[model samples]
Every structure is written in C-alpha cells, then in structure tokens.
Target: MIMMTVLCIILGYLLGSIPFALVIGKLFYKTDIRQYGSGNLGGTNAGRVLGKKAGISVIVLDVLKVVLAAGLASLVSEPAAIWTSLACCIGHCYPIFAHFKGGKAVTTMFGFLISTSIFIFQEFSYFLVPLFMFLIILYLFKYVSLGSICASVCSSLYITAQLLSLDVNNLFIILASWLMTLLVIYRHNANIKRIQEGTENKVSWL
Candidate 1:
C-alpha cells in the first residue's frame, strides 16, 4: 500500500506538471503564455493571449491531466487515489517546473469530480446543477474568477452534503476537495480585489 501510494503521488505529480498551456502557446504562437494576459499559464490566459482554440486546447489538456492522475491513482487504493487526484490538482496550481506558479486548477478539479466513481448520476447531477449554473453565470458576467470560485465552493458544499446524507466513506475526498478549492481561491486573490474595485478584466466579447 505504501509503495502504491508513493508511486501514485510521483506519477500524478509528473503527469500534472506537463504545462500544456505553455507548450501549446509556444508551439503555435512562438511565445510563452505566461508572458501575457494575467501572466497565468491557464485556459483563461491562453484564450486572452493566444486564441479561443488554444484556450480550449489548454483547458482540455489540463482537465485530462487531473483525470489521468486520479484514475491511475485509483488503481492503487481508494485513499491513495483520492490523494493522488488532489496532488495532481496541487501540481497544476503550483507546478514546480514553472517556479511553483501555475493556473487556478478549476478545470482540473472538475475533472477529478467527474472521474470519481463513488457517486452515482444523481449525486453528480446535484453537483453539476450548481457547477453548470455558475459556468453560465460566469459566461454572462464575464467574470471567470468569480465563476471558478463559486463553482469550487458549490462543489465542496455538494460533497459535504453527500457525506452527511449518504454516509459515503471517503472523508479524504471531501477534505481534499475543500483544500483545493481554498487554494484556487487564494490564487485568485488579485482577481478578487480587481472584482471589488470593478477593474477586473472581462471577456472580449462582453
């Protein structure tokens, strides 16, 4: 078990650190995505600096990293798997290769939630209702930071409610989820301030 857990952590971290946004940006645009637009190697920055296509590609790749890490970890042990998923999310948020700076891990968390098998469709539906709603709101308001924060909070709430009602055995998952949510929120502190001052960046279409 110990060996499996260690292996999962290492594998997940390495996988999560691929830095797809940087890669795609450099490959197609001949520039480092981190050099522009909020200076974040994330989908939002990718979209702003690169293009919508590059942004979507970055989002898919980031989410896939979480899914791959979590799924591989599950093969070891349930607890290890959950921890591995969280580790991957951490890696995405603060990639060591990128001077410990990275994206907010919003899409990565969504991937983890969707990949977990413990919850059935009903539970997932309850979770997704708020998630999708917030996404819509974000799109309408052009406040990606607010949307990401609200979605993370809603996900944590949904999981906590599931723990209370369904008696699911994995408190680690809930705890990890909350921790990641907090981390994401912390990374967005600047955005929060901009939002309060009504100086936050909005979508170009808006």
Candidate 2:
C-alpha cells in the first residue's frame, strides 16, 4: 500500500508538471510564456501573453491533469486520491520539468477540487460551489487573482464545514484543501501587494 501510494504521488507530480501553458505558448506562438506577462506559467498568464484560446486550452489541460491523476489514484484508495491531488497541485506550483519555476497553481488547485469531489468524496457540491463562487467573483471584479484566492478559501471553508457536519474522520481532504489554499495565497503574494497599491493587472477582455 505504501509503495502504491508513493507511486501514485510520483505519477501525479509528473502529470501536473507537464506545463501545458508553456507548451502551448512555445508551440503555437513560438514564445516562452515564462518570459512574458506576469511570468507565471498559469492559465491567466497564458491568456495575457498568448491569447484567449491559448489560455482556455491551457486551463482545460491543467484541469484534466488533476482529474486524471485523482482518477488513477482512486483505484488504490481514497487517501491515495487525496494525496495525489495535493501532489499535483504542488507540482503545478513548482514543476520539476519546468526548471522548478511554475505558476501559482490556481487552476491546478481547482482541478484537484473537481477531481477529489468526484473520485474520493463523492460530493459534487464541493466542486460546483467554489466554481460558481469563482465565476461570480471573476465576473464582478475582473481580477483573476482575487477570484482564485476567494475560490480557494471558499473550497477550504466548505470542505471543513462538510467534514464537521458529516463527522468524517478522515482529515486528509481537509488538510489538502488547506494546503492548497495556502499555496494559492503564497503564490499570489506579489499580486496581493499590487492590488493594495492599485496596480494589479485586471483582465481587460472581461
């Protein structure tokens, strides 16, 4: 079981480290996304540096990676699935294949929320609620960073509440959610500072 869990984690990290944003930017535009915009290897940066189509494609690919990782881990056990999801998020943030420099992992975190909600927790609301929250926040403010931060916080709070109400003894899900939330916040520290100074970039297309 332990060996299987380790293997699942390795698989998750490798999958998450695929760096779809970088790949799409380099392949289609002949530009490296890391050298442009916010220098983030995330979907939002992809949209800014590349185009809407490239950004959307990168986001879809990022989400799919987490879904695939969690699905494969679920074959082993729920704990493994949760761990794999966290591993994927970490890899997205600090990808080994990307010179250890990666995005903020906002999309990757939501990907985990979607995958774990379906494969491990069997609770769709965990994914849907945060997604709705993100969309509403994004539509209103046009700040992807703000929306992502809010969504990450909402996911953690919702998961914690659900675990409390349901009396679920397994703390792995809650741990993973909190970890991802912190990671999102940590990765967005620069953005947060910019927002305070009223210089944060807002999505012009929105």
Candidate 3:
C-alpha cells in the first residue's frame, strides 16, 4: 500500500510538472510566459501574455492533468487518489522540471477539487456549489485571487461537513482540502500583501 501510494505521488508529480503554459507560450508565441505578466507559469499569466484563447487552453490542460492523476490513483484507493491530487497541486506550485518555479496554484487547485468531487459524490451539484461561489466572488470583486481564496474556503465547509459526519471515506478529502488551502494562501502571500495596500490588479471580465 505504501509503495503504491508513493508511486502514485511520483507519477502525479511527473505528469503535473509538464508546465503546459510555458510550452504553449514558447511553441506558439515564441516567448517565455513566466517572463511576462505577473511572472506566473499558470493560466492567468498565460492569458495576460498569450491572450484569452491560450489562457483558457492552459486552464483546461492544467485541470486535465489533475483529473488524469486522480483517475490513475483511483486504482490504488481513495486515500492514494487524494495523495495523488495533492502531489499534482504541489508539482504545479513547484514544478521540478521548471526549476521549482510555478504558478500560484489557483487553476490546479480548482482542477483537483472538481475532479475529486466528481469521484467522491458523482453528482453535478457537488461541483456547482464551490464553483458558483468562486465565479460569484470573482465577478463581484474582479480579483481572481479573492475569488480563489473564497471558493476554497467555501469548499472547505462542505468537506468539513463530510468529515464531521464521521465518514471514514472522506478523511483524506478533508486533509487534502485543508492542505490545498494552506498552499494556496502561501502561494498568494504576495497578492495578499498587494490587496492589503489596495494595489492588487483587478481584471474586468464583464
């Protein structure tokens, strides 16, 4: 079991560290995405430097990586699947293949959450709740960082409900959610500082 868990984590990390945003930017635009807007190696920055199409594409690709990892780890067990999801997020945050420089873990985190919810609840409503919270917050505040933080916090309420019910099956889910929250906040520390000084960037998406 332990060996299988370790293998799942390694495989997830390897797949997650592919740096899709960088590849897309370099291959098509002949530029380094990380050297551009916000200097982030994720979809938002990719969008800023590469345009809406490339940004959306990167977001989809990043989400797929997490979903793929969850699918593979499901063969092991629920806990192992959660571990794989966690590993993928970590890889996205600090990709080994990218000199340990990566994005702020927003898209990747959402991908993992949506994928896990699919497998755990197998219900569309399970994905809708937090997604609605995220979109609403983003739409209202025009700050992607705020939306992400709020969405994760809202999702934690649902996961915490699962935990409080004494559902052993959800133990790993709760653990993974909290870890994602901490990692996301840590990654967004700079954004948090900017927001505090009312200097955070706000993109109007209408």
C-alpha lDDT values of all predictions: 0.78, 0.89, 0.84
**Per-residue lDDT tens digits of candidate 3, residues 174-202?**
87888888888889899989999999988
Question: Model 2: per-residue lDDT, tens digit, 51-124?
Answer: 89898899999999999999999999888998898899889989999998998988898899999789977889
Residue-by-residue lDDT tens digits, candidate 1, 72-123:
7777777777678778888888888788788877677776666553422325
**Candidate 3 runs further than 4 Å off:** 204-206
- Quality of model 1 by C-alpha lDDT: 0.78
What is the full ranking by TM-score, best candidate first?
A: 2, 3, 1
Error of 3 at 152 (Å): 0.9
Of 2 and 3, the candidate ahead on lDDT is: 2
Whose TM-score is greatest here?
A: 2
Clashing residue pairs for model 1 = none
- Rank order by lDDT, top first? 2, 3, 1
Q: Report the Cα RMSD per candidate.
A: 2.4, 1.5, 1.4
